[model samples]
Target: MPSAEAPAAAAMDGEQRLHPWSWLFVLLQQLRQFVLPLVALLVFGGGGGREAQWQALAAAIAMVVLVAVSLLQFFTYRYRVGADGVTIRSGWLQRNLREIPFNRIHNVTLHQSLLHRVFGVAEVRLESAGGNKPEAQMRVLGLAAAQALEDVIRHGGSDRAGRTPDAAEPADVPLLALDTADVLRLGFISNRGMIVVAVAFSALWQIFPERVASRWVEQHAQQLLGYATSMHLGVLSTVAAVGSLITFGLLLTRVLSMLLALTQFHGFRLHEQPQRLTVERGLLARLRTSVSRRRIQSWTLQEGWLQRCLRRRNLRIDTAVAETGNRSDARALKELAPIATPDACDALIQHLLPHAQWPMPAWSPLSASMRWRLLLPTVLVLLVLSVPAWLQAGPWGLCIWLWLPWAIYGAWQQTRRAGYAVDTALVAVRGGWWARYWRFAEIDKLQALRLSHSPLDRRCGTASLWLDTAGASNMQPPLRIRFMPEVQAQALYRQLSAALAARRLRW
Candidate 1:
């Protein structure tokens, strides 16, 4: 077998070799220039009896013309690699030149489809730091060549060691690399995709009647019925079995869909460089993403039931700076690495913030009064459910009563999961129960800081501190550190305020 380093070396040598069909690929991408408007014209033109025939003929011609132009362009485009940077020069009528410096390059991702794999060619994506768009992608490179190019960009190309801009690499950095097992663990732990599929299923069911949908449902009902009957039995066995089977079938379908979606990142790996961290993964479409330590504004750790059982966690590092150039062109940069163990996550955090403090002073828990205050939502829900039950005069009243215990339990769990810790330099907020998350932010990143007390909170001797950060509105519990004893909340607010007030404080 070829050594791992062979791929990197081969890529460097292959960069100068251009694929004959590269230009055709470029043209295919730009074929929309003519085909789209032509499509519009054909659809709305010829308003008489000949309209249908004309539209059909026009559509066929348009498709052929588009394919022909795309093929032409794909064959013509080519690129070359040099000592300083990679250069791409293409375009038939309006030639273009793009040179990307090795030092500025942040990530090099390789994507291979079945077709590309057969041809031994892969798409190489180049992402640069400190750029508005951050990424430039091109196809036609051999697979080995693509991986080699990635290695050069990641390790800083051989010629770039002493002469490259920003050549000074940070020392003593910790890099975490995920194995195949970790990828599988992450696949099972992720439920976001499952949740999405479930919601979509629910929406479709609501929009269409069950009778109309039952045909498809019934077709697969036997498989579900078998699974349910194997696991459960009861007095109303047949009816209960049917209902349970349907529910399990829906859940099983969602889980399978989620697993399929996660397979995209099946072979994930994290490479920690001296100055940055790089994540590379994909099943069909590979992606390489890197983030500089200096640019990471905040870090969040999340764990759900499966993750907790597996002792794994997901890490999300948020950067204040946006890859704006790519945004205008509608490109997405990779973010979020799932299923890192707690120790691995902690190490990554420490690597990003070497000198920062750890496990800051745990804030005092919420007062007993505050715990009672958390029950208000459950009380309101119970009352709402009771009203309809009382009017119906049926077993519905008992059904409402059955839900109260679960509601109270959920409230208690939420209260237990909420807490905060503050140190001179950082603040950590913990939230969620089944899906627990820990968010860490430096004191300096606060856009706004406040100590707030609701009328009920004040009476209960509890308060909450809201710390807002730029570009973090998407975060859950956007306002962190909710529901604490008033004194503790006030003290934390004062400490954070003082840190912000002092110009000497650094993140």
Candidate 2:
């Protein structure tokens, strides 16, 4: 029988073929990509008749083709491990060859689903800087082989200090670890429950027949109306009943969110290595990924109202690796401390950026007119919307103006909370009232800087400054300071630009 390191040895000597079951994983992955359409077809394609027979025949043919393609790919794909790099060759007809140097690979990721674990196999992805896709991806390999490959690449494709690739080493220094209780806290503090609910609702809507949905709604509506008529419930009672139902729904969502957190973050741990940081997490589906210490481009500290109440905060990092377009892959690298105390967060930041002072003593406030500038858009929006409200509800519609006080209060809070801080080593922005964040990057890591003035800003004598960093996420707010004095904005931009020009980017 072949040993666990057999695959690694084979690759080092010549070329290696993936595990025998690689085709199954490839097939499952492809199927997952088109699951929604497949669900729709399965739900709606079974109407009886000659048309149904044709649909069934076509589906069978498609499945057979998918299976054949997966098999073909597994047979054709081949990779070799070399002293300086790795080489991959694939495609029987087209034929492609590629080589990736160990020094250029920025991210090394391993994923193991429950099935993969049961089969003692794992998936590996090697990502390079400034590419939209992974440099190389192996669908399935022996767990030991995967780790050995990671070790070889991390040590510049050579054994470390004359030891074998699979030799055990000193214990890793622990940076952070999450237990079940911490994961539960994170779930309660996250809004991922709502996202999960929305996705589940979409799936149900796609799968359920229109008639079934209509019937379910009709039955519930009739039942509610009959109960109300029979009880002759007062207005207050009706309101209480609706409120109770909403409360129950909210509790259910929280429970679901907790389950999600457990699945995604159970057994989470962060470890500090010689030149890289490693993250290991997940319950049934595991992930192990590493990023070089110097590859970190920026950092963010996020604290929501709930997190503050729980005395927890989230610390994330941005790296120079190109966007993978996979949320799971992004999460593997970004989440350094999913949930940690304020002190722990500070310690982590200090350890990573020892020169850049963590938790600067004071922050420079934005422009004096920042409050009104923020409120101007809200006022105009309310005014425009009130017209429709008046058209429909008469005097009651005018109550929409009641929202103005709340908007004004929010603007005031935002203005007070938002500020920027800078030093020779770092530039940072802090903002957001209810859900607050601190975003910062080293001076050398900044890619670009912009100073802009809107029409209103010009009239108000205010401007905004924006800083660009590598691998920024579209979902997160930019590192910006809005409604600052024009002079201050210009000075900050020039200072950062000068700093960027003077130092070389580490990543």
lDDT of 1 by residue, 93-199 (tens): 78777887776564545556555656666667776544555446775666666666665665556633344534554452336666666765665555555666778
Badly placed stretches (over 4 Å) of model 1 are 1-55, 61-110, 114-174, 192-235, 243-262, 321-337, 360-363, 384-389, 392-401, 444-447, 450-463, 477-479, 485-490, 503-507
Candidate 1 backbone overlaps, count: 19
Model 2 lDDT per residue over 34-76, tens place: 7887778877766789988898898789889999999999999
Among these predicted structures, which one has the highest TM-score?
Answer: 2
> For all the candidates, what are their Cα RMSDs to the real structure?
7.2, 2.9
What is the TM-score (0 to 1) of candidate 2?
0.93
Best by lDDT: 2
Ten residues in sequence with the least summed lDDT for candidate 2: 1-10
